[model samples]
Target: MTDTPKPWRIKSARTIYNNKWVMLREYETVAPTGADASYGLVHIHNLALGVLPIDDDGHTILIGQQRFPFGRYSWELPEGGGPQELPPLEGAQRELSEEAGLKAAHWLPLIADVHLSNSITDERAFAFIAWGLSADHSFAKDSSEELTVRRVPFAEALKMAVSGEITDGFSLVMLLKADHLLRTGALPPELAKRMLAGS
Candidate 1:
């Protein structure tokens, strides 16, 4: 047999639950082995956006808050959801400002598209590296969020990701990728130079 694989044949699908934020659907399908099976999928109504904001001194921002679902405090890169109608980059920028009170003059996408929790959810994420940052206090935090913002050295953030001190999957991916980019000289010369200079 050739390496090409056939797609699963979907017999039927029905939405079991739907709200403004997410939809749950169940699908009856025929597997590649011709076996009948059922699958459940969670469809997120918005795009997941995350930003790693770095300043000229190689400092990155982290936002802390108590995660309700997980029942624990989490420190992560500034992250939020973007409506499907909005561009992912715009959403990232908005989250950077709202969550951390910072804005960037330069933005580079770190992770273009990631299928977070691919097995159970159709949730996708876009992450970015933002530099040339400055304070922007006009935007207010969301009512549901009580955030504590911190600016830490880039190396420290990377360590947090590696040590599991920061458990958010999106944040871990972004920080690890940024560290790789910086170490490999993959970033633009000027930006790399700034990011290498620790505060």
Candidate 2:
């Protein structure tokens, strides 16, 4: 006989709380081990979006702001949330322009459908590497956000991510993946050459 992996089976579920942003639900589940337990799930309603805007000079943009949940200031890639119905690339472009005042002529999907915190929340994230950027001065910052933008060499940003200075999971993942793609020649030869030049 062959053994097959079995997933947790939900016996019953009910919403405990819900808001515009997220929904909390309680579930009675039977584990693969046949043990019964209760699980709390947080379902995020929006798709998380992230953009690494790389300029012609091989620099990337970072945004610094006070993250309310962490109760501390954090420096991370340009990120925002988009409606679940919106295409990920479109969302990335919007976030990049809104947060960094830059628009990209080319975009490559870096990571797709990444479950940010799967153990507790169904929060997923998508990221893109954008290049051939131009400034858009008319872009306005989101009224609720007060951000500080910095343009740094791509190599420096990767170092920051590696050193834990850029602790935001989404940003860290994107930076590391970009570094990998560039080193492995997975990106366009011309772009990869320029990116590695700054390293």
Candidate 3:
């Protein structure tokens, strides 16, 4: 909705920091309330792509890794960043194959360009539900990545999301939404049945 009204007006902007992944800028602006204001914006260089893979047996894959920023081990969907100029689906597919060694015959768009932490950052995310999967032995990962992949029943994965065991924002949202769509007759009957088998 480009016609949507924006009350804040930017007077000036300058980059405060720049890195391979992000750029931080300080903006001189006029607030919605008609007051002088300054805001800091974090501009992400790539689009976040997330994939939740469901196998024929109602099993879903998760990847375990140590998060550099959090300095802790985390379990999450196969996710990574895609260059802004590339299609998000390609990135999602690559992440799934490389991190989980699987490829899907069918992919469903779950979420698209959802902003994360919009208050300060312009990081946008896309998610997909992938099924009809099979192993891809030639899958390759980034040299810097060290991921542990696990396959768990979809029902158990959703339980983990509810129990706070899966805390990654992208994974949490995708898992919960997939469960909702499956149970509510939103997805194809056969696919839903396969993914909800033990739920």
Best by TM-score: 1
Residue-by-residue lDDT tens digits, candidate 1, 55-86:
88888889999999899999999999999888
> Which of the predicted structures, 1 or 2, would earn the higher TM-score when compared with the native?
1
* Residues 45-151, model 3: lDDT tens digits: 99999998888888888899998998989999889998999999988888888889988999999999899789999999999999899888566788888889888
Off by over 4 Å in 2: 137-139
In the order shown, the candidates' Cα RMSDs to the true structure are 1.4, 1.6, 2.3
In terms of lDDT, the poorest run of 10 residues in model 2 is: 190-199
Error of 3 at 151 (Å): 0.6
With candidate 3 superimposed using the best TM-score fit, by how many Å does residue 57's alpha carbon deviate from the native?
A: 0.3
> RMSD in angstroms, candidate 2?
1.6
Q: What is the lDDT of residue 99 in candidate 3?
A: 89
Evaluate all candidate structures by whole-model CA lDDT and list the values in order: 0.90, 0.90, 0.89
Q: Give the C-alpha miss distance for residue 13 in model 2, angstroms.
A: 1.5
Tell me how far the alpha carbon of residue 150 in candidate 1 is from the true structure, in angstroms, after superposition: 1.0
